[model samples]
Target: MLLVVNIGNSNIRFGVFEGDECVNSWVMNTKPYKTEDELYSQFKIAFKNYDIDINRIKDIAVGSVVPHLTYPVRKSLQRLHNIKTTLVSKNTPTELTFMSPQMGTDLYANAYYAFKKYEGTKIVVDFGTALTLTCVDKNGEIKGVVIAPGVITSLKSLIGSTAQLSDIEMRTPKQTLGKDTEECMQSGVIFGFLSMVEGLIDRINKELKEETYVIATGGTGHIFAPLTSKIKIYDRLHTIKGLRELYITQKKEGLQ
Candidate 1:
């Protein structure tokens, strides 16, 4: 079995995969001050909770945007088990020739998974901490990318700094023109983000000069995908699935 972990800006999502199937999954809040022992303790507890044998995890593949947690995660996994642990990056198994040097590993994983998981020209829009839109051809090369403020980030930016507004549920309000403050905020966030998605997809298609298969992911993607016809696929596990693929690819390439 393979233990795949993707560390995002807000959450740390981990999955236990039996071959290609993800049998168990869990999410942990990303805390910068965590020690390696504390990190490994959670893994042991999760295995116990899910009835997943700790001995079954033969490989640990990680895709992390949090730099501070990277070493801790790897070290903790190493300390807990003698299995191989890897950091999936463009410089590793996944190829991102066109991506900028500063591009996050999670984006590369999403692109690599989309390239192999689907056929023909594909564009993946990951609605994580940042709304990342990536285009990759059939051969697994990135064509372009667009990064924008994410749903929660935008909300926090609007409310976190301002004193007038409070947090609102991520749901489409009864009407676009809301009658109250909460309703108005919900409408603005849900509908406004939808507009951004549609506009981006349109521009991406125009730039590519061809229609591409669209995939939207992340925990919040479900709220937006149904509202817009632009997203043809919605699989939240895209990154971890790609992580598993990258693990196999790295072994196949004989990377030590």
Candidate 2:
């Protein structure tokens, strides 16, 4: 079985894939200072509950945004289980040409695999630490990207900037016109972010001739997808799925 790990800003998500199917998955908070044993123990307990044998995990591939934990994760996997690890790099097997090849590793994997699965004009809006808009042109080239404050980031910033704005629970608001402070915050965050997402999709669609398939991902995408148009949420596992594809392709090509 292949282990696909996507280390993001907020969490580190892992997926155990047997062929194209993801049999099991888990996620933990992204803590840079956390020890390897702590992370591995957490993963062990999580996977053990699902009846996944940690010893059975042989090959592992990683796509990480948090650079601080790079070596530590690699070491943890190797030390804990003797699993062979591989990092998804720029030279990694992929069909799409990167726009800014060195900007971010996770974004590169997302765009590459998005191009591979869904052809033609597409946009991958990853709702992570930041809401990143990655555009893949009709010819399957990484055209450009737009990075905006993520839903949570924006919400946190709004609360931080304004003393009157109280912390509100993140959920669907009953109505657009909020009746109370909590509802008002929820409306602004959920509905307001929805409008921003739809607006971006609409504008992108207007500029292009081919119909663009917008794939929404990250921890909060599932919540936002229901309230928006032209946005499809494939859960947060898509990132790890993308990494797995690249790893399998590279293996087939005989590239380390």
Candidate 3:
């Protein structure tokens, strides 16, 4: 069994995988001041619900985008779980086209397994603290990716900079055209972000000369997938899934 963790800015996602199948998974906020004891106790309870033992997990794999939480997580695994874990690094084996050191750990994991499993040319759009557009060639190599402000980030900036613009919760807009202030803000942030994604994908297809399969994963992925045509929605836990797949691949090849 392998324990896979993907730590993002806002949340920490964890999964227990037996080979390629995920057995249990859960998520918690990425509080910067969280003590090792707090995290360990929470993880222990999460595991206990599914009758999973931290001791039984053979290999541990982690991918972290939050630098502050990484050390504590590593220490927790080392001290409490007694498992030597491998942090996904730039130098790790991947199919990306760029230099290893330049890629973010989040994009690295998603682009790797997405291209491998889906095949052909593909794009993985992650809607997190930022919107990440990662491209893969027909040969399943990470061609490149673009990162931009997230929907909420844009909203916050607009609200902060303007007096009339009021902050609103993220949700699907009732109609593209809004008649009120709240509705208008929702449209601009939500539908506007969808348009941005579609436009970028269109440009990538035109330049690359290949019809790429667009896979959406993140907290807001499901909300936006229906608003657009021909988009596929996968669980936001894709990065964690990819980490497990890569770990298994390395183990089978005697690379781990």
Model 1 regions more than 4 Å off: 94-96
Encode model 3's per-residue lDDT on 1-256: one tens digit a residue. Answer: 8889998887788888876788888888786558878877877777787788767888788888877788888788777678777777545665556644677788877888786778688889998879998887767667789899987677889999997888787877779898988888888888889999999999998888878888888778878888877476656677787777666656665665
lDDT by candidate, in order shown:
0.84, 0.80, 0.80
TM-score of 1: 0.95
TM-score of each: 0.95, 0.92, 0.89
Which one wins by TM-score: 1 or 2? Answer: 1
User: Candidate 1, after superposition: displacement of residue 82 in Å?
Assistant: 3.3
Per-residue lDDT of model 1, residues 1-256, tens digit only? 8899898888899888987899888888885568888989987787788898888788888888888888888888887777768777766755545657877788788888898889888888888889889889887778888899999889999998888999988888988999999999999998998898889889888987888899998878988888877889899888888777777788788874
> Model 2, 1-256: lDDT tens per residue?
8888888888888899987899988888885568888877876677778898877788999878788888778788777678668887657866667657565777777777788778577788888889888888756678778789998889889999997997777899889998989998898889888888888888777777557888888888888878766786555776778788878878888876
Question: Top model by TM-score, which number?
Answer: 1
Q: Candidate 1: lDDT of 46? A: 72
Please report, as a residue range, the 10-residue window in candidate 1 with the lowest summed lDDT.
90-99
Off by over 4 Å in 2: none
Q: For residue 233, give model 2's deviation from the true position in Å.
A: 4.6
